[model samples]
Target: MADLPDNASQRRARAFLPALEDREFLRRDELRGLRFAMEYHKADLLLREWGVRSTIVVFGSARIPAPEAVEEMLAAASPGAARAKAERRARLAVWYERARAFARLASVRGGALTQRPDRIRDNVIATGGGPGIMEAANRGAADVGAPSIGFNIGLPHEQEPNPWSTPSLTFSFHYFAMRKMHLAMRANALVVFPGGFGTLDELFEILTLQQTGKAPTMPVVLFGRDYWQRVVRFEALVEEGMIDEGDLSLFDLVDTPEEGWESIRRRGLHAHTPLAEAPDATPRAVDAES
Candidate 1:
């Protein structure tokens, strides 16, 4: 057996370390609750420091490419399925440009270009912190010198945060639930583009929240009207009685960037302190589910 002196030294070394400094101890399953809270507060504290009062979230497929990149991609293709897919994406590339345009328009019109007297910035762009539409939105914000956020989540394949997002505002999370919370909590509006499983997941999550009254109402605009209708039979959901016809009113489909922005404005989207407009203390955070 090891001497008592050696055992005492081991205990002393570990005991001297601070709780936060003990990375191995922190990773234990028993410390998961603390980790969850840490994840929540890390982003929360940083966002508060930046005075980001609200955001316009942009969600879409990370596979989509900007129009200029399409020609290069097609040229590099091996032909057959790859070339066919490239051609398909070439058509979808229009949505990428439109996403960029809408983001710039929103950032400028929605007051992200300036901070108010309270030092809070509203209607700032926020994205999943990955490529495709996320990159485009962040790029748009950059075009006008406005800051945008990217809440990136660690994945099996390790998705990188897009370069277009403001460096200081970009964050990474290990837990998808924590990432989703941050995405929803501070969002003032959501502009969804044509996407696949991931995009659908984000879109429906927000819609469910709004449907159940778990979240405050905000503008929900889906770009690529023809694509979304083809992809989702929202009318079927109503017809089948899985959802009410009135629930269809929850979001609008638009084609152009101008139409998307106009739809948002027409749906009561505003640029200033939305939550702070009310004097109530409890409204800011009603509960964790929000």
Candidate 2:
């Protein structure tokens, strides 16, 4: 451990260590001890810093796919640029529109909910702390001029906390498990965008936690119908008797930020009206069977 990098983030990741270790050569008890030591000692301070409550875990692709990037870039342009470009630049134009739309949604209501008068309890938007959709989500939260949290982990590529996160709340972790723990510890909901292996890992981990009675019943919403349908045949898996049909209800599919906001609002409002009891003060059962 002394030979490892001295930086806090790198030291936390044990970034010097290999991604895979074969335990076959070690005795079962020895392997267990090794795992315990690795998990228990890693990232203690980072996790402690994350604290509890008022958070959401958002996952998505960092790559931003070329077409999507072009769309975002063009859509951000002024009217003069829009008029000058030919129809061939349309993909960029669309992305620009989506980005602006996302920005607009983030700016209006995101901060208002956190205002002193509203007194919403234990709620913050949490993200993988990377680029792409993760950035978009945190950026949305920031648009409202409120603090947002980022749970970042060390990855070889396509992983870096976007500049939009609130400084005090940013956390970088070495252990994915610990990072996920923070995500679930106070997560009121999960909002997923399109991504690859990392995204699927997070999506399934949360499902497993809920399915196995590990976490409280929380909303999981997938954005972008086209991107989600292409990634996994989840419905097909359910149809083949791999999983119970009702399990499919664990998540909802939606296309817009308005719908995402509504989904979270519904859960937040489930136990109270605007003038009624506070949401968290009420006791709720952890019925994973849902």
Candidate 3:
């Protein structure tokens, strides 16, 4: 074969040379571990830079519409089977309002809008970054002109981040585990509303961490006692010996937003202080699994 041309040698070098900056190379399956680490560190650094000491996580159904949307949905439904579904949705729509009110309470009380540069933001509202209760919670924080976090995840159906979340603080994740990690990492408390499988999964993840002593103890408020009682028989778990009776004490049941806020306040790691004072609080460790 004839000797390769000078240009051919340059082309071969370009093809074989490692390009660390190449997006396609970084996205390969072989680099998955690096991706995980990047996800963890990116969120960790952003939160720290924003001075988010701890979060108040809100978990609930994305299906629940806003209070105003409930009436619109009801009106749009046909008078037969669809009407029943619409009515049920309307009933649950109250939770959206409750979630919003609870978030506002937490943000205002937890010093989200405080001007004290010396204090880190505590109990900043955090959500799954979708519609429904997440939107309500973010909106509540925005109502008070406070910054909030939204940890959005990629899904087949394409869930969008709520507009009310602090635009700079919002994040998107491809890994469910990473998303969940960020959710619980700095959480000072959790307020759970009536939700479906996704909500239950997230609720139990935190419960398991608390039970195992892998995570710090924080208040977990289950909104709507009637709905939770109907859904989960915590007493049954005790009777069956699957969980200790003390496990029931891990979470409190509440009916209203005010009650939920009070429950969390009573159990929060830090005492309530005036917005003017610099809050003395420590960052909760992110190493739950450790």
Each candidate's TM vs. the true structure?
Answer: 0.89, 0.63, 0.88
Tens-digit lDDT track of model 3 for 74-131: 8899999999988998888889988888777677678675656665777789999999
Output the number of the lDDT-best candidate: 1
Worst 10 residues of 1 by lDDT: 281-290
State the local distance difference test value for candidate 1.
Answer: 0.86
Best by TM-score: 1
Q: How many backbone clashes does candidate 3 have?
A: 0
Compose the digit string of candidate 1's lDDT tens values, residues 55-78.
999999999898889989999988
Q: On lDDT, who's better, 1 or 3?
A: 1
Say which prediction, candidate 1 or candidate 2, comes out ahead on lDDT.
1
Better-scoring candidate (lDDT), 2 or 3: 3
**TM-score: which is higher, 1 or 2?**
1
Segments of candidate 3 deviating more than 4 angstroms: 1-20, 275-290
